[model samples]
Target: MAGVELLTGRAGASASALALETAATRHPGALTRIALIGNPNSGKTSLFNQLTGLNQKVGNFPGVTVDRKTGVSQLTPQLRAEIIDLPGTYSLYPKSLDEKVITDLLYDRGSAQYPDFVVITADASNLRRNLLLFTQLADLGLPAVLALNMMDVAEQHGVHIDIAALQQELGVPIIPMNARKGIGIAALKIVMAQMLGAPTVHFYEPEDELLPMIRQIRYYFNLHNDYLALHYAHQYRHIGFLSPDDRAYIQELTEKYGFEPTARQAQETIDRYTLINHILLNAVEVTRTERNEPYSNRLDRVLTHKVWGYLIFFAVLFLLFQAVFAWASYPMELIDEGVAWINSLIQTNFNGPLVSLLTEGVLAGLGGVLIFIPQIALLFAFIAVLEETGYMARVTFMMDRIMRKFGLNGKSVVPLISGVACAVPAIMSARTIENWKDRIITIFVTPLMSCSARIPVYTVLIGLVVPDVPVLGIFNLRGVALMGLYLLGFFAAILSAWAMKFLLKTTERSYFIMEFPVYRWPRWKNVGLTIVEKVKTFVFQAGKVILAISILLWVLATYGPPGKQEGAEQQVRTERQRLEQAQPAATHTPTENTFADETERLVASAKLENSYAGMFGHVLEPVIRPLGFDWKIGIALITSFAAREVFVGTISTIYSVGQDATQQTVQQKLSAERDEQGNPFFTPARAMSLLVFYVFAMQCMSTLAATYRETKGWKWPLLQLIYMTGLAYVSSLLVYQAMV
Candidate 1:
């Protein structure tokens, strides 16, 4: 088996392998195109990851926004293949946008995505249900192979499969596999590199009433498979590859012959299932007649109990939030030290505007964002583990009831949860919701779920106001504060949705039906990959905005109207001299060293207050005063519109412009600030107020753009902006006034 280089024990397999080898020799540079298709959650993606590893990229298909993942797999030392992971669908009949992508690409031979061969992954335990999709693709006359995935799960259930018998019956090769553990990978690659046989047994043939219509379509399109021709007749309107004239021709013929597409499609499915069942009856057998309940089922009794389920879910969330803060603290400190070291080194060894731009502007701003990577990565890792272990599906199932009360469904939970990583993609995920009203409402509220971008802001502010003391002998108070802010956002989102339920009218209703996948240990490789990709997106995307704004903010804070800065500095000096003169010469005063330090601090503050950034902040200060925000905070509020995470960078660059970079971190700089009354500037009331504002504010322009993309208009986005801003302002005002 280790030396299985060619597919044997099947008729014509040797010749197929020979032909494949010859073709490879003739065109060594060309990649053999293969597609992987299966039902949703059938281990299709796991097999894909095994086959492709890190050699993958994601993009959109030709004309649609649905993700297209393609990767190169080396079948042999010399044979390489390009693998396209198509969206999972139950069958050929399309119901949603994702399923339609498969139908369109399969029906159109000219599509760039059309594969030279297909590897249909099926769940070994649920072969009866998974085979329906495999049989449909076989009937399309494409060269195909069936990879029986999840063999471990099947074996655990006391199910036994006769691989040879099933392959003989279906007239195609079947490889038993557990994709997660990389079992049977060598055999799969061996068979994949060989020429494959199309199914000799066609599972579905057109009935007499539909044969004429299908035949006409087959002849007009010069197609070889009857099932494919039938697909065009049934799905011409939705198929993107067909021309207007082609669709019209099919439409005209359908009406002329009175072809019933709905009836014919339903019958075709029924007929195929009948064939599949008879084939499996002799090919598959159960090893156990009486056995204890499976582990997953036993666990579900407690894990999915209505009352216990919710509690367990929240408990998991609590631990996750706590871990994010506790586990990431060391790495975050290291990053902080590294950034400060680099800034100090640059400042000591260099001098000029460009050096200032690099250290004060670029380093200060980007360093603020980089220090939080540990926390962000930890958060993403937790999420990835939840998804990998199949617990996320249970969460969705548990939330369906709650979601409906607020004009949403269980499907809305996915986007809202995804918003924890990013609102842009989370809003895009709303496409899975079919009902127009449900999707719109989901998009409207997804941004309110505190995303990873806000973690930097939240952690900093929470650390300022909330002590890091142990709670209940384990929990960190800061972590508790982080959880409270997230829960607050969640509550705000649902409450807003409930209010909108009656404000907007729609007759369309939506329902959610989902499957619970058996729990498995989290795949650490997949988890690692997810963290890498998410961190990259966060750094590259947010870093760009932070760098540009950091430079701009430094300019605004470092220099003002030529005469104004000088005048402000002179005024500070003049006041100091007047104070000295008023003091008795004999009165004890500060030593020369202490006096110089105080004078420098006073002069820096005076100049900054009159700089361009300060002038602009002063304008916004009056409006934000009710919320306990001062001029510097007002500047941050305005600059953060570009992105919420920029608030930290803006603060860093502003504080570092005229200060010693080596002496203090952003938190220390802020902690040492004072107001006119000589009170700590970032008091608990003001810190909490700012946190509340950010939790509700529509500060990310990317989210607004994503909303427009999802809703296809400014109508909803504009309303979202206005209502969210108003909500943030009012909420911040209330929190500040009450706390003060």
Candidate 2:
């Protein structure tokens, strides 16, 4: 076979080659292809970061378990290269979709691009299990290098291996280094350069003593059935080879081979393990005793215990929710003030309708959406710390028993926890659960978790009603009340899942299988990157919708029904004339300034009352009247359907009319407002009712759309909408009645 060579390096390399006296020299850009493959938790990502730094993009594969991460790195001053980070997997048999990604890119015949070389990253502490994947990759006949990651950890554990011997046996170059500390990176780079310049090495099945045994097994299987040996051989030789087509083929082969295939698989697993064990024993040595650490396991003993585990979990959740409200308040206030200042500046700098639209509509709307970034960042930061500490897995394990009781999988905890950040990613994360029933149930209930979108609404309502009072000695009662709302969402999800269990019947049995990686110090770099990416995505995605809605709302408020503005001016002029006629001549005719002020007031009121949004509010008034909502409040509710955070901005814009004129805060504006009956509209009763409404409302369109896509039908999304909306309505009604 003719071999085609590709180069890997950083961005911005030349795309030309030079002919030397005895050889051809390719320019730097020709070397831009690097493939990253590794076992799960082997620090492959850290290496990818070191190589690519800030030059990477994340996207999903065409239709697979893999997230395609591509980046550029400068290998040499003259060469730029592209790097691909493949999904983490154990072996390459493709038991799951994530693993299939690596295998497909490597050997699939239909693939258009193939890596020039493969970088196999192995965990130093667990070399035995890690080496198994490397050996398999080597067998595929690709030019490969071994990256011995976490060398520091391996030394701390007193484990040692002769690098030269291991590299000789594997027929590859080995570089030992700590990816987290950036050690041995230079050596690894040099080795990569040498390997890329050298001739390609072809690896094939070794002719060993086991070959006879393999042949004998094949012969025995062939005698029993025609395609049995062929099928097993095909599976063993292919790296990333599982798909629906492969499954169907296996099913057909299974039926033909009968009972022998099952027996043969068990035998094959045992054979692989035995061979791997022997190799590890001969090639590696452990000089130190295993540490009897009690911190992690002892903590898990109580945290994952059958009973106390749940109590601790709930306590942690309560604290997290309370922190989301209490801790975020200071930053939120700063952001609100900053936005108001920007708006004031914009108004002063420009004039006309376009300026008004830009200031009150687009800028206000964008600011409203952007204000939630601090809260999202804080929430995700806390979650990252928990995950980095390795406690998240224990949470899943502990919740499994109780979750199973509610007909939800333990794995559902991932999505549910993530839902607090944003339902979009939380819904997507449900894909990690392999069981169809469990995945569907998790997706259906995930949005019920109070997402950050609801934070502004909750904050406004809670501030208005739940008075600040010390409770249980130190904790704030208002904080406790906020926690209760989040807990309510959690319980609601569990109850719904229990009902779903009885409603949807399936024969598939649930299985709980997860890895418990060794605890390590939190990598701040990774945590920072996660926070940045999540915040960026949220801001851009939500900003688009809020900006559009704000523009539409501004137009509706500015241009009322025909003749409405003229009618307001005429009414104001008539009122001034009447007042002048009744007063003494010494009072002097009412000033033009007074007339202009009266006209402005009348115009503002008329625009709001007759605007399209006002019409919508009037239409829904009867339905929401019982829930203690006025026409203005009703309009805010409708716009907030796009996102709960928009509620604050909607209320701000609506209540900004004819005010003390310069005050900007929503709370300040709301406090000064009064109804036609001369009572404050944001009464405690109404605030409590709105709070309850937001707690249970299904108002996020992105969530609804994601649900539809995941379930591949409208059945679940429709059910979610009906169920959540009904719950919100009933709950708000109850709260209003009790409070009143």
Candidate 3:
């Protein structure tokens, strides 16, 4: 009611008066906070997307790693609301971190993120199951509106609900919606502007046995609602907002009353469902209509078939990789040429150390990061489509049995698949796996799944070694090579998981229970948004690291200890003069220019070999030389410990220094490199060896930090770093030796 009045010029109020009132009432034109809560797959997020459009941003909730998506929605011309998409959960009683996040915020009224009003999205087709959480939230006495989503799906299933009757019976506003089609959004917004008061109805009353304890919790905590007090009793220890003194008092009271929270919570659920069943009787109608096997079920027969399922899944990945290589080529080339042109422009116009820093250090490093955007965007696009279509769930279902054999829960498949995007969140996602050992094992092996961060490294290396010719007149050889690297990472992960099965022991059993959402066309808007978000994250985040490292690297490579660089240049000049004098005039006439250019190149190379970076690389060379890496490559390996993708940026900056006027791409520079013996560096054997090394290496410090946070100790992350590094070293050595 207040929101409505603020939006319209009321009581003959002038426009200026309304503007003044708005500014004074809100937090200096702050957005009203509205939270969207629902069971999983209830079309909650779809509705959020519809409301927020391009205004959405993602962040973590306070101290937790679970993604918090918030956006601004204009509910009216004068009123904007900040929409918070809370994680989906079945009930308020927390089972996982995601579920805990929901209860934590809802129970903590003092928290800034606490919603002014809640929009509960319920599946019209599965009203009874969906309303269980709705009833729980209602008892918390929050002012809320219900969005009855999936009306079309309900109609197709021959289920009809009387919205007016349901609203009246439940004592809340109910708006019928097909969120995918953008229906009822306007109506929902209208109701939200005129939000209702907190519900007066008690959906579930605590029994007398528990009332005294609930009363005590309510009195001590200053909670206005009995359900909030009961939740504290059920989940006191896990509550984030509660202090040590609060928890201690609650624990003592629990002992005093001989209360069993779990049993009481179960009884509460049964009571709520019974109440929901009674309330739905008059408002719901089901028609018994004859129908063929449902479309989703019919398709799942083949998609989830024992043998065909595995083949289909692999074929999808194969096609995805093929597309990544085939479609991204043009954009990648454009980006590469663009960077070179800019580099050339800067070099030609400017003549100072500052110019050199911009051209060689900043531009080269950022260029490496930018060139891979097309490929990264494409990879994220494919992943988004798969998830949006609901087929990713089937992949999880099909992999359960296979995963169990490798000492993983079926849920482990999510993190492994997620790792294909990035390992940081993939490791965090392992919290969904309840069993301690299963979660730890998933965390251990996830980084081995080649993430998008490795794409630039993989693409550059694969192009150097693998031909672009088509395989079987369909698949590109380069594409297949890229896919092979990914598969190599995957198999390595599972095998490592199998070995760790014996090393870390646990008797606790694990179960993977998941729902299969109905297959639907991918939401192109959501897909596009995902692509933009992922690419932006890659460019900006990687750009920062690359730029810093590149500048530092340039400084190290450009100068050496006092007189060493100048002495090397002088020595090259002396050698060139001797060669020119010893040669015959007629023989030198045609090759004179070539001889001078070669002499200049030698001076540059000699100076680089004497620089600080080169010195350090030389120190590391003997350790890595058996694997076919030169000191330059050694430098990349050491610097890339910060991040795998930095290897490309490091190579870019390293190769750009003291170069000829001809601007070459990073790959071209690498290809033109020669070893001391006049043999080509990065031969197929060496390139493949580097590829295999990155496939197993724990090259990301952020991933290590994430693992440390998730596992709550340094022991696992340190072990992870050591084992992964060892695996990378041994595997690369073996590959290089066998091929060479």
Question: What clash count goes with each model?
Answer: 0, 16, 0
Worst 10 residues of 2 by lDDT: 12-21
lDDT tens string, model 2, 270-387? 5656666776676678886557543556677787777898889888877766676568778978888888898898888879988888887888777766666676677667667677
How do all models score by TM-score?
A: 0.79, 0.74, 0.82
Candidate with the larger lDDT of 1 and 2: 1
Residue 562, model 1: lDDT of: 76
Each candidate: RMSD: 5.9, 7.6, 6.0
lDDT of 3 by residue, 218-257 (tens): 9998999888998898889988878999999999999999
Q: Whole-model Cα lDDT per candidate?
A: 0.79, 0.69, 0.80
Q: CA shift at 339, candidate 1, in angstroms?
A: 1.8
lDDT of 1 by residue, 88-144 (tens): 888888776667788878887755566777899999888999999988888888778
Candidate 2 runs further than 4 Å off: 1-31, 64-66, 94-97, 103-107, 194-265, 290-328, 407-447, 450-486, 497-512, 549-602, 621-630, 642-691, 699-723, 730-740
Q: How many steric overlaps does candidate 1 have?
A: 0
The best candidate by lDDT is 3
Which regions of candidate 1 are displaced past 4 Å?
1-30, 196-201, 215-224, 240-259, 407-488, 498-511, 540-632, 639-692, 699-723, 730-740
